[model samples]
Target chain A: MTGAAARTRALALALAVLTLLPFASHSQFFVNLAMLTAISAALGQAWNIAGGFGGLTSFGHAAFFGLGAYADAILQTRYGLNPWLGLPAAAAFGGGAGWLIGTATFRAGLRGSYFALVTLAFAQAFGVLANSLDITGGGSGILVALHPGAGRFQFTDRRAGYALAVALLALATLAAWRLSVGRFGAHLLAVRENEDAARALGVPAVRVKSAALALSGALTALGGVLYVQSYLYIDPGIAFSAERSVEMLLVAMIGGAGTVLGPLLGALVVHAIADTTRSLITTPGVAPMLYGVVLLLIIGLLPGGVVRIAAVRGDG
Target chain B: MAEAAPLLEVRGLARRFGGLRAVRGLDLDVQAGTIVALIGPNGAGKTTSFAMIAGFVRPDAGSVRFAGRDITGWVPERIAHAGIVRTFQITQPFAGLSVAENIRIGAFLRTRAPAAAMEQARALGSELGLAALLDRPAAALTVAGRKRLELARALAAGPRLLLLDEVMAGLTPTEVNDTVALVRGVRDRGVTILLTEHVMQAVMALADRIHVLAEGALIATGPPRQIAADPRVVEAYLGAGAAARLADG
Candidate 1:
């Protein structure tokens, strides 16, 4: 099949799978698995906007993730605001933070490994600040009241959360697809490849990168909001963890950093492995160890990620 | 009939790199619908001047105006948007992208719609004799293929003024001839070109006016024939041998 046809088929398959997800045999287990997969896919898609398309390998994306979770938690628990209202708010916060980080560093001509370090530092600092803050519930975290209703976003059934997560993931995927085909997408690719050349060709490097990073952050924050909503609690350690950030990157990187479907495939593969390993070995720490080893093997084999491998195959 | 105004005007443009004056008060003009060649000895700051014009380098002194607008110290993207696009000495094709996709990125500027961009890219590829190679990966292209890719990419941008830096540097004679033809075709489409080249034959054939630089200064500016005859230009570019040949002609 042609590449476009293959992409279309893959997309159709993903949609079909997501549609049938709520009806699967293992209702509770599959719901949890699908929710995790959706969240991971959404986060990975978000990261791909900057890290994949813009070639800004961010190691600090969890800052936005944590921000979204905390923003939702703080608003719901302390102020009695609905989690729904916090969705857009979290997106805005994430986008704003991304803009600030992207501009300050990109304007100073930091990229590649250096840019990654700055992102890492930002996440670390945010984590530290979150831990030190009294109003933010410190490291102990904030609790969200679980009222099984549409208004509260707390559902008695896991299917509802799974469905919502799927919706968010779908939206993220659609946005990624749209951006990857538009003028902004072209500029992002140009900046990713050669900033000087892109600039010479009229691609505003700073603005494009900043916008991409902001979009990435916003999408990531949206996922975070969903995560906290589903869980009904948030803590600095869970929300602002570097390991969480690495997980996000792994999903995007292992699939293909730049392509729209990379993160989704990565999430599917990762979640499959995690599920299989958890089911087979009922042992502690083995699952995480296996996950790490699998990630390393994938990275070693496909340095550019599975999406790139697919692209190569498609080209051939 | 030539009242469209110069596309670029540089006055006393200068730049220094940590106590070294790389470009010193250079003045130049590139008129609309003309091909101007900048020829200079190595380290005479030819590429630096191109970089400044393309806004890669900030001028320490003087003004740069694009199409009668003061664009001094403007950002590179803004300058490019203002219709001044540049090519590198070495092509920087996105290795991961197909040749068609690379050109499609350039064509994105002409129209925001993806369909329109693809159409523009297809048209450009056909014009550049790259229709057959469009689907190929840019990194897989040969050297001459890269030069073509570079031109196709720059042309795809729909630039009003194209800055070509050593595009013909490493081409075979046949490829050089083809490139010269390609450039003329591009010029015929009404895009002004400012090319920096070491190839005297291509410069003589394509450039409407020649500007010879020596030590970051414009030593001579005139038609190719007049430029070839200028003592300073001949001395700077060629030695007494070329000067004698020009004098005899």
Candidate 2:
């Protein structure tokens, strides 16, 4: 097997083992951490498809993430629908939001830093809207009662939640792998490298780009749905925050943008750093500031990101 | 008497950017299995004409026909779907992708299954002398290699007609010879070709007929030897000695 195939097989085995670990060990805190890592990694992977492959870096994916969370929250809380069914509806809303943003901005010709700014503005706008809306629980948020059995998708034990998140993470990774090797991935990368050349070669620049944005948005939404369910809570500040969106982007960028396992590695590093920082720092805000400094250093030293660094060292 | 339809045709093609006519009232016909070269001075709208024909630039007034089907103002994808493919002046390769993968993308337009596309890409890659670079990142290739990769990719698309924009640009003389041979090889596969190049020797050596463009219009059209003798083409377009070189070739 090639390196990529070998890595994939290893990942599959790891996930298979992980599914049984929760049942074996049944540790709540470990379960929580595992679930959190998986969810974050999935979202980061989603962002990588467009930002990394399509080279349309977006700081606004939180809009889709928050919308997905809120859509599920509203449907289940207000309309009394099941969370399992509501997930797809939430993802669709996320896709629509992606389409709307991509169409308006790309047609008017937004690119590079300017494009990033536009996405940031949209994310900010979505956050503001979420905060002001009453039905969405506004800033105060919605709390759901935990039902800890098999089908409720909620668990007091936390291990089942970890297993669910692991499954989701595996799915997201598989998707990223397929795309990186597939025709759409090649076309998107071509667009990223040179728009004019790609267009001249009969690659549908607009439709392919829009489709990438939508796919990224929907995948991120899946992570967001799992996030809301695991915590059994939803709030505009938590879900739609600019910081959260940046966190997702930062993870993907830090790991490696175009590589399949970059997001997962990034999530692992971020979680490890967070844990270490919490132990060292007494102040609440100091940890995030330290993370920011470290990110800046990483960008300065390895702009292609850590995955590239590892690839160069032949570690990956 | 029955006459064969042109493999590709452009009629009344005009593109105006506000006040300037980049391409105005341009018409072209490409016969099946023939190599037609469009030669011009810089800023003479040679690339612009190719862009309009390939559907990258929507003409203000014009229709493009490929394989006898109207493809006027269609998007690049739709035009490509109609069996007309174009290569760029500056070779654009998917930088992070491998050579085989890059060609696979072009082949995907013709096939539904990924496996079939890969098979076509592999065969095309070997034909284009890119079998050795099949697993290497496209960015790692030299300029001449990149140009060849682009050509190979376009050919992998199974184009009935190909519009090659300066594929010979910046190539070494030896590379140019190799590229000319490749172009002849592609033509042998029954793909009609329309190309733009400043390289007189290569074009004269390869093109069955040559069209000279000066300031957005066709100034002259004839065999390579005849175009060399045209005074208007010599002074207005191909400089003094360029005509002599064409004559020698």
Candidate 3:
């Protein structure tokens, strides 16, 4: 108990300090960079819940992400609601969408690549809808007014936006941590390992998987809300980009899926590589190509992701 | 004398897979706290019957009644929730997780706390002679160890009715003997067990009653001694007088 308490306290302290570090960086460039990394970490951790732990490989997480961004944007710009309200709205809508997708696919017994394709289709379909919807401002997109108030969830200090991002990542990290040590997590991992075996032992496989997706979707949606609040503008292409979906999975996979700190570590490395490549190469295609090459090397060399490296080091 | 109703009762349970009549018109009953077995040659529909009872396979015809309530075609998890737990013929352990974690998931059925589940899992592991392997990965275990782990995992669920599929399918005679005693111990703990096995020695030693099947239907049902002597059974499964040979062995 004492060890557990100490570890938890240390973790909380670490997260708290991380949220405050952006303030110390006077350079706007560094602050924005930190914000992006934190955003990626949160999104990655969100995907990890379902993808890593539950063995639910979703290829279209952009669906929930875009839905959340659009939910906030529309609610704030069109419905004339407080941006803070968008936080809960995003979670609700994201969770609901996640539940819907999980129920539909799992009930139909879709798994592996089929489930992945279905989620991808959902995101692609949502992109089409967002592009054409009247309330979404269609292809033109919507802009959130620059309201600098805590109630509006946008702080006048640019670093405060970074703080919000850090806080979101912390919440996601905390959720993953909770799952690793909890009963629900045990059932989930059992289902992932062997669904029929788990069912024989009385695990409600479908329910557990569905609930995990909902939780993951809710958190992922919250990440979308953070993005909109930080930038104050969103269009269909930016909100529903397939590349963003790839980034979320890459962060978790490269950092080590099913691990608590995988996404955080993945976010750091992924963004560092992105930033370095963008600065070093002006050719747009070259930057993406370089990113792909580096990722391929990491994945090929460390198949279990960077977190497994920590495991090896700890044991050896 | 009016006998109490059976803990489990199957009436005319049937299923057909495409061109094959896998199970047809099968009936079964087991009283509380008894060690019964469903025995037959391969494709005798013993496994299929067990699957229907445990809710893994839906029956094409007839009903499954437990404690006087109909539970036909319920999902496997829901049937397990009703105190009926089944273990696979092919051992299924979460390979990456530790032996304790494998049992802990079963314990999770009754408790929501990890500490409690882990504690119970450890206790069950030790009871099943797996204390030393608690922290080891499940995939590291031998066939005998996996069989024990399967039992420990099911026992952790505190099941009233345990359906074991070929639990002793592949094991040394010594290991089979150990499992026979282990199963008898489980029955003494107030669990009703229904097993499907080709292990005749185990069947003779453990089963209070035995049901014999052939070609998707029951051809004989009696006590272990009588089952060994049934002419229909001997013709269908056992040789002309294997009972005397079995008794000698």
Candidate with top TM-score is 3
Per-residue lDDT of model 3, residues B1-249, tens digit only? 118899999999999999899899998999988888999999989889999999989999999999888999999999988999998899999987899999998998888789999999999999899999998899999999999999999999989999999999899999999999999999998899999999999999999899999989999998999998777787677665665566678
The runs of at least 3 residues in candidate 3 whose Cα sits more than 4 Å from the true structure, single-residue gaps closed, are: A1-20, A282-284, B238-249
Candidates, DockQ: 0.71, 0.52, 0.88
Cα lDDT for residue B178, model 1? 89
lDDT of 1: 0.85
Reference-based lDDT, residue A83, model 1: 77
Worst 10-residue lDDT window for candidate 2 chain B reads B1-10
Of 2 and 3, which scores higher on DockQ? 3
User: How well does chain A score by TM in each candidate?
Assistant: 0.94, 0.90, 0.93
Give the Cα lDDT of each candidate.
0.85, 0.82, 0.90
Q: What residue runs in model 2 are displaced by over 4 Å at the alpha carbon?
A: A1-23, A145-152, A283-286, A314-316, B238-249
Give the better candidate number (1 or 3) by lDDT.
3
Worst 10 residues of 1 chain B by lDDT: B1-10
RMSD of each: 2.5, 3.3, 3.0
After superposition on all CA atoms, how large is the RMSD of candidate 1? 2.5
Rank the candidate models, highest DockQ first: 3, 1, 2
- Model 3 docking tier (incorrect/acceptable/medium/high): high
